[model samples]
Target: MPSTDDLKLRIEAAIPGSSAAVTDLTGTGDHFRATVVAPEFAELSRIEQHRRVYAVFGADIGGPIHALSLVTKAEA
Candidate 1:
């Protein structure tokens, strides 16, 4: 089970200049909701933005990370 801080670090590391806020939706560490803001998302579609975020976790999505709900935004 990955900690929320760990997940936030991974996301921020994976995407340069990005800010991620990860929360454990459940008491367990498997389910999460991440709100990410990045300049890279400016030109991408919502789906594409999500895909980029999801790519950071790779195989962990359905394995260690049972569920991840994402809310992404382009940097202001």
Candidate 2:
């Protein structure tokens, strides 16, 4: 199970100029909710933005990480 800070770092690293706030929604370190704000999301659709963040986790999603709820926003 990945920690919230680990998830945050991975997201920020994967998406340049992005900020991620990761919460352990279930307190188990496996369920998480991430609020990601990125300049890269400015032109992308919501699905696309989610895809970008999900890509950072790759096979980890649904594996070590049980569930990840996401809220993505384009940076103003």
lDDT of 1: 0.96
For model 1, residues 1-76, the per-residue Cα lDDT tens digits are 8999999999999998999999999979999999999999999999999999999999999999999999999974
Give the number of colliding residue pairs in candidate 2. 0
Q: Which digits, one per residue and each the tens of the lDDT, describe model 2 over residues 1-76?
A: 6999999999999899999999999899999999999998999999999999999999999899999999999974
Model 2 clashing residue pairs (backbone)? none
Count of clashes, each model: 0, 0
lDDT of 1 at 51: 100
Q: Score every model by TM-score.
A: 0.97, 0.96
Q: What TM-score quantifies how close candidate 1 is to the native fold?
A: 0.97
